[model samples]
Target: MTEIQDRPAAPLATATFESLSPITGDVVGIHPVHTAEEVEAAVARARDAATWWAGLSYDARATHLSTWKGVITRRLAQLADLMHQETGKPHGDAMLEAALAIDHLAWAGGHAEKVLKRRRVPSGLLMANQAASVEYRPLGVVGVIGPWNYPVFTPMGSIGYALAAGNAVVFKPSEYTPGVGEWLARTFQETVGRPVLQVVTGFGDTGAALCRAGVDKVAFTGSTATGKRVMAACAENLVPVIIEAGGKDAVIVDADADLEAAADATLWGACSNAGQTCAGVERVYVHDRVYDQFMSVLTEKARDLHADASPGSQMGPITMPRQMDVIRSHIQDALDRGGRAVVGGLDAVGERFVQPTILVDVPEDSLAVQEETFGPTVTVARVRDMEEAIARTNATRYGLGSTVFSKSRGMEIAERIRSGMTAINGIISFAAIPSLPFGGVGDSGFGRIHGPDGLREFTYAKAIARQRFKPAMALTSFGRTAKADQQLATIMTMLHGRGTTIPKD
Candidate 1:
């Protein structure tokens, strides 16, 4: 999910629409263009379904989710094929995406009890007469608007966690992959025997409708521009939203790093899935000591990769036709600004697929550097030291994810980057780890949709403070006296008035 997905179709009402294959321009699937009324109906049904679903114990819900996980695992190949037809990604990439999603679903189900369940907290001396505890309660229904790229994995980040948290979901998949959305929903219904998960297939109107459909929350993933619009719609109803939006992720390579490994990771991270990943590597900052050598290895590998309709090609066609213009414009902007293309340039932009492109010496303000290209393109810049590299890496307004390559300084460098997740000596490793929360800061959007944070994202905290005994000072009652107030002040002074120690990370 990133800046490269298809923008929403204009709000022209239609009965049905066809999902086309980007590789062949053939209709892959036809789905009804659901209306606002229809979307409301689905959410309404989800509201009822959520009540019953939430009533079950965490273990019972886990069992149901675990069963659904098995079903998806069994039909992994089938789902992969549907994804390939709709998103034009390689079958292997699709399979990997779905497989990771399954892992997350399993983790969400198996761990929700521990992460979201009620747990006791120590009552301070001031409140010693009470037994205090806190738990996360499910928001009735969550509206999930997913992106076309990595359709299965991205949406499930929200859908799976929300369900595991005991909320029903109304998923509105990208208009480019309605079939995939329906398939997920249909399979869940077959196993759960209810509307715990439902799909509403349509264009942007349907998504806007979901925000206003009185759902407890909405989770959105797309371009930053689209995210703002989604937030506005959700705000109309004062609904909470988790937006996993666009990113211009970067990678920093130090002189002490493994050059060959960094080259491979950079090329793969930049070109894989046609570079539509929200967390995909778009900018590279290498220590000048190893910049030339690193470029030699990176370009050599980039040359071996090409975007075609080959059944087994690791690089596939651009999923959205409209996005081609943005890709071309970014490339042209860098070139016009005096950046030299080392591997590919304007010629690499094709009708459907884009060849892996590497540009060097691009200005920091160039579109290819400042914006999310959402294409198989990368910009390389040489820096004098790790200090310069870190500064440049953190310069972008978008910080969804980042990578740092340094044998001794990997962890240190990773900690300094302004990204939600940083992979040190690895490529997007945080995504595969279900316990790590995945999201971004600044313009990359807010909130999270993975791990414990993800499970709580669709829930409201419920704090319970039961009275165990009468307090010496009745602060809440009118009977509270001046003497009691003095005692409270004295207790506060003793407990918190002095200097305190901050715990170390």
Candidate 2:
């Protein structure tokens, strides 16, 4: 068997397996890890659902979505528990993510008609008499390959918007979180009384199957290497794709910043979810003036956080075992290159749980700074000024999200950064606004998954033009005369042949 097939859920037959708790290693639930055949079947069912869904008026779809939102709200605790069990995130964090997703769902459903309705446009002076309009049409079926981190919020960014835009969705959740995927689909089906949104669970192969299952578009979220593979797979069918890949996002602290708040935001951004977030702050550049103060505060904050399998644990296991090795390697690289660990260091990584780690004075080229460790580890560097901090922050190829903690220069530094979203004063708060677009640029991947842009990503632009009246001069037929041609030339000359002074009344 391939190395991927030998992972945690390898023995399942129909892409079905038991989800184990990352902390306790206990089997949480059994789920089906769908194969290509199941994905095709789900898509076939979705295609029929899409036809009916597309025929419905905007109000009708909104009503169904409202009902689904109510169902999710009623079972919020149940779903959050499943999320926490499968992904090993804090219960409050899981609930917060789910609540935000529901908010986006409501936003998408309420605003889709306004954002995508037909609108008139000028046809330019040459065709001023003719009327032209543009509208967005659904692309039929959309496939979403979700990640394990923030499983609900991330995938719903695509699924909720796709459905609001009158498209059916077939989602393949990460193997580690298939139970959450199934829970979402079940709730949706219960509310809508149709498989408008279906779930197919599996590892990467099942995700690959969804890409090739003839869907109109695919929205994938994962590592950069895996995104490339997903893109190549989708390219085989010429299907459009939206990729929300990984990031080594950085946080910048200026001389005018609040050292305590900066330390709090940085620690939360770095160690949250055991540091498995795509937009997690993995690197930090602090002004030299507050470097010592920020480090001292961060060390204290991180010390209070612990990764355990208990109910009230702030941090949990790494979820994926192999990721432990990568996290270790990154910390080791930083240490070997003369970096000092102010908190948990190389010994922080255990068999499952990874302790919160904070490294200082790490070389820029070290793996901790250059690669996505995706663990409870962060690297902090001291810079002379904001310019140096911004320059070093923008040097990485990944620009998914960043945090700026400057009181006076927050906006200035945020605009100069090469990331898609920048959270000033807070870490990753832009994701909650529902108005700002979220996605990365360059190697971090392209296309957005939230707000109006998310609604449009699952659709195609359709333009329509109709002639309002025939022109006064019939130049199409053999009716053109020399006098008419001379008149046209005179008009052209007066309008554009040469620049002229403005006429005085």
Candidate number with greatest lDDT: 1
Candidate 1, residue 345: CA error in Å? 0.7
- Cα lDDT tens digits, model 1, 338-385, are 999999899999999999999998999999999999989999999999
Please report the TM-score between candidate 1 and the true structure.
0.97
Structural similarity to truth (TM-score) of each candidate? 0.97, 0.94
Using alpha carbons, what is the TM-score of model 2? 0.94
Error of 1 at 280 (Å): 0.3
Find the 10 residues in a row with the least total lDDT in model 1.
1-10
Instruction: Estimate the Cα RMSD of every predicted model relative to the unseen true structure.
Output: 1.8, 3.3
Model 1 stretches with alpha carbons more than 4 Å out: 1-13, 500-505
For candidate 2, write residues 1-505 as lDDT tens digits: 0012225445545545778988788999887667778889999999999999999999999999999999999999999999999988989989999999999999999999999999998786556667999999999999998888888999999999999999999998888888999999999999898879999887777888999999999998888888888899999999999999889999999988998999999988998888999999899999999898888898998899898888888887788878888999999999999999989998888899999999988999989999999998999999999889999999998989999998888898999999999999998999998867999997788999889999999999999988899866656669898887887788778866777754332
- Give the Å error, residue 342, model 2: 0.8
**Each model's lDDT:** 0.92, 0.89
